[model samples]
Target: MKLTNKHFRIAEIMAAFFTGSQTEQDERDFEEWAKESDRHKAFVNRLLNPEEYEENRRALDKFQVEEAWSKMDKRIGDTKVRKLSSWRSVVRYAAVVLVLLSAGVYYWWNGEEVREEVPVLYQIAAGTTGARLTLGDGSVVDVLKDRAVELKEVDGTRIVTDSIGIDYSTRETVDTAEIMNTVQTLTGMEYMLTLSDGTKVFLNAETKLKFPTKFQKEERVVVLEGEAYFEVSKDVAHPFIVKTNGVEVKVLGTSFNLRSYSDENSIATTLVSGKVAMFAGENSEEIVPGEQAVYMKETGKMDVKPVDVTLYTAWHTGKFIFRNETLEEMMSYLARWYGVEYRFIDEGAKKLQIGARLDRYNNMNPIIEMLKKTGLVNITQVDNMLYISSTE
Candidate 1:
């Protein structure tokens, strides 16, 4: 049977369920996704939780399950991608080799030692929100906790929460030399870290930020891959530095977001406050608030432009914002966040673009809703692939 996009989506959920949701958090996550929309829930019921569908969990796999589903993200009348979901679980025969290896690779062939790979990973089950953090210390922290755990307390630092928001006091502290290193997030996790200098760092999923627990006498710096946001602490004596995809952001005190996902083709740095000097391996430009710096990996080229800062940093606010973005771009984030599979079956579908914003931790129906509004496309799921087609 031809795999429809509906079937592909159903299979992604099944993969999440079959992969094992042993932890209490996992169970809660499944429930959250299960209740997001009637379509999503009904799809889950018909192809996943039922015993009948469970009986045929061997037909869904085609290397492009996620991409395929991106093709058929819309719904078809009574075609029941749900039915294909159960029968197609076993179809992915060749996916064993294509692991999305984001971390553990050096930013450069002869890069610094700080770029070594960490062993732990954060995986999000399908359709749920929140992420698990794997620290370099071999400790795991759940960032979604109602109250964040102070893994350790810095001397002379205090946490103050008010209408102005929480403040970390840096009255005084000893300059004891501790092992400073990089911390990378697994695919399912994003993180927020406060450096010794009081600079706040926000990480996107599967990003690695390598920094010292304490600053060296010479500099305070961190390397990144994937995406992260920074609210720089003021320090005239030293500066804050963020490294990603071979580009560097040097600032004395500022706030910005760096997006350099491995799966993505470009490295983007958006400045929200203060100022930023964005330098590729060579070219340099200064970016102020409301501006962005984009780096293309292939040509080592860059473009610094002005944009809506809110759109660039919206992901940090638990929102996925897209501004005239392409369908492929949206699907990439979906593949990571929802942990769903896709099959980009429509060659020309890549030309379709969208501009929308939806809650990061919310159900995915909103994305589909916007897709339907475009009127240029149609979606259907066959087995584990979503086939998006152009009306023209």
Candidate 2:
């Protein structure tokens, strides 16, 4: 059968799955497709077998490059091509041969000399769900998705941690005194928390949030050191307040994202639903849904503007949405989530603007390939560091 768009999509999904980057939805779709016929099930099983993988690799090594190139040339017209430099590149090309035996989509391999000068790019895995929880008694606990634990705070507040997240809803606070607890997520880690008041907070990588075991009768308040998306539980009498840097975001009952990393030049608060009032020093601004409040740390200036909230809030939904963000800014975000260091060899490359939406859970290979295909910059990995230079 001739390869159609659907076949290409399936191939892409298979590649993602083999690379350990397929999403939950991808797995479901793949399993559903594989159940359509016995042939499909057998093909998936063959791919999963270690011996079959070696056989496929050996077959790929003998694929005819010249004939395959001729066919590809006729399909896409004239196009310039460059020789791949390393076995890593060969493996990448070989991964494209999904359903090869049945679809007749040829795999091409040229026995060209390997170029040692070219850098080899390695895969960097995505972040996972984990955090450090510090109770009011000054005890630190490592909270991970795979583990389950139960603890009682000094204030008699009961905290339960399960696969979903840290839950503080079952409050058994005996003392009326305010007891503070903090949840911190390091680089390449994220976490979710259910506050005592039933509010849900999604903490991003490299973020820290400090809250009380039980809210005061007057108000609910939390201190933030990095970034988090909050869905505040509605309580008309007790307003929810998030304090970060010098800015304060106050909402009665709403959902919003606040980003205030120390390394970032500015703090941003993006409102997703309902209303929020952001205060910085003497200046205060109220932002409705689909709006953002930006507080410049250097200039002590606050500005409110309408924005596509998804660009700022997508992290809560497992996506990285960039809207013409500078390469330096984009890399900073990636570096925090991927736990990889990056340097721009060509200083000018740092200023290049990039606009794309990427799956936050995907490994670095596909993300790197997407960036390289943009023809804007060249990215190569050495150890855990990514060197970015101009395509020129």
Off by over 4 Å in 1: 1-144, 147-176, 181-183, 381-385
- Local error of candidate 2 at residue 25 (angstroms): 50
Task: Estimate the TM-score of every prediction.
Answer: 0.60, 0.70
Cα lDDT computed for each candidate against the true fold: 0.57, 0.76
Model 1, residue 35: displacement in angstroms? 41
Evaluate model 1: give its lDDT: 0.57
Candidate 2 to native Cα RMSD, angstroms = 14.8
lDDT of 1 by residue, 321-389 (tens): 888887877778776666555564334566788888787876555565568578755544322334454
Task: Give per-model CA RMSD.
Answer: 16.3, 14.8
lDDT tens per residue, model 2, 1-392: 32333444465576565556679888888888888887677666665554454454455445433433333334333432222222122222223344332123333222332111223345799999999999887989999978999998777778999888999899664856888999999999999999999999999999999999888768798999989999999999999999998889999999999999998999999999989999999989999999999999999999999999999989989999999999999999999999998766445679899998899999877887788798777565555766565543
Best by lDDT: 2
